[model samples]
Target: MLDVLAGHAARVRAADPLAGGQDRLPKPGLGEQLVEVPGAVGLASMDRSGLDTLNATWGPLVVHRLHARVGGPDPEAALGALLDAWTAAPRREPGPLAVLWPSRDTAAVRALAVRGFAPTVTVAARPRRPPAGQATDPRVRPATADDLDGIARLYEALVAYDAQFGWVTPRPSTPARIREHLTGTLPRSWAWVAEHDGTVTGVVIVDPPPRSRWIASMVTRMPAAYLGVMYADPAVRGRGVGAALAAAAHARLDAWGVATTLLHHAVANPLSGPFWARQGYRPVHTQWVRQGRPSAR
Candidate 1:
């Protein structure tokens, strides 16, 4: 199993150098199953009740998670067999059953697409670069406690805007949950905001390497930072507000000597794909999801 996964990692890293060779495969815990196919192995893990225990903003929670060691010639068959074995049983929840695969590994798409999964989100990454000149707009500035409400409103708008894409759902508790999260992380987190005529119209937040350790293993780079939240008012769209906010964040990240910066965006978001691409971020991993019908068959 370890050898299979290592081979899979090598193939993936060859396609995308930013992909971390998952050298450390921890022992499967309770509710995790190891399933096999012709030339691959898959570990189907359950996160039963996991989402309910986490911050509400950390959602679009998937209960059934499938990880596969599939680098064989028939990548689609390997993955399709694994999915069949994993979803053989009826699920207890209506949440999605998901598989996160390397972005450049297009061979596995047939398996996922045939199984009803859709590429919903991307875990994008970009390596450190020299300072981007200066923020395009001078109105961008660091965030403070007094700016929390404005930030929260912008975040809610972001969620609402994204929910239309069918991946990120807007929950009633999302507003309060985001505010509560920001209240705690804002003091220590690196954040900035854009003001338009004295009203906060945009916000960006990041967790430095120390605070972003929860997801550190996702990449091979050292001292990675997570761009946790970023949103700008609709009125400020097409202005340089978003670009300026990103510039402020990247300048600080480069100064910190961070190796990689990571964030997730909906794959179907017309605005997101182009915006982040312009910022030099490319897809490292994509999360494909089969939603709603997990409980049906």
Candidate 2:
């Protein structure tokens, strides 16, 4: 298990070398502080530089973001302290308190929602199932290296969909970046496209569990997998392409023997919440991320 985490950390380092790059971020105890609790250990990575960046960008908000893995003794105390530190931090404004959790943790996740942190997004997924039917459609196939362009375009669509919130950076979403991510150490990162009469209608990207950071949080050392990042072209919105792609992805994962799969959807996206609900997914967890300057007093 440690080796797997280490490998994942390495891959992430390779992808984003600027974010501590195999030095500060990946090391277990090198973080600013390690708060120990039963069944969990909180690792605070708030270095002076990190804190300074937050203070500058967030304007007087002492943003204390801690990433803790629940594996020690008691996690509740550690989590409590982490949250308390953020809430009590001296901010010019009330700001926001946020935590990202694997959507499978319904109770703990919903608890935060009830504590005034409304859910910003809910990613839902269909657990892996056995391959019951061969993909009769000619559009969907195992993604080959040559299909990188289509995959990138697919990701662009997904990112554009996310841009409505204005949180994503306006960067060049290109094929090279998509290739780096899809071909990286993250296993089962597959893509498929829908073509009809020689024209591409939609695309789907399916990544297995444990490879995904979100899944890694809840499915650690478990015999489960996840499904994520399903997007369809807007031109084919009501043509059943999205459902077909999603169903195919589910069948692929199920054949892989993943106990369950998961993904997140924006609560803000119209009809998204209901669309997944109709597909046998429920509100398993709620995550909130409120961004603002600190109190200006």
Best candidate, lDDT-wise?
Answer: 1
Clashing pairs in 1: none
Regions of candidate 1 where Cα sits further than 4 Å from its true position:
24-26, 48-54, 133-136, 293-297
Q: Name the lDDT value of residue 212 in candidate 1.
A: 86
Candidate 2, backbone clash total: 24
Per-model TM values vs. the true structure: 0.92, 0.63
Candidate 2 per-residue C-alpha lDDT over 1-297 given as tens digits, one digit per residue, 9 for 90 to 100? 343235434543443332221222235555255544433344444322222231232122333444534322233443454455545545442434455544443323333544565667664545444567755465565556665667666766676676565333224323445557766622457566777675556766655655665454432233444555667678778777777776777677667676556666777877567767766665543456555442410
The reply for model 2, stretches above 4 Å from the true place, is 1-84, 90-96, 101-116, 123-125, 128-131, 172-176, 183-188, 209-214, 219-221, 294-297
- Top candidate when judged by TM-score against the true structure: 1
**Residue-wise lDDT of candidate 1 within 9-29, one digit each (tens)?**
777777777776444344688
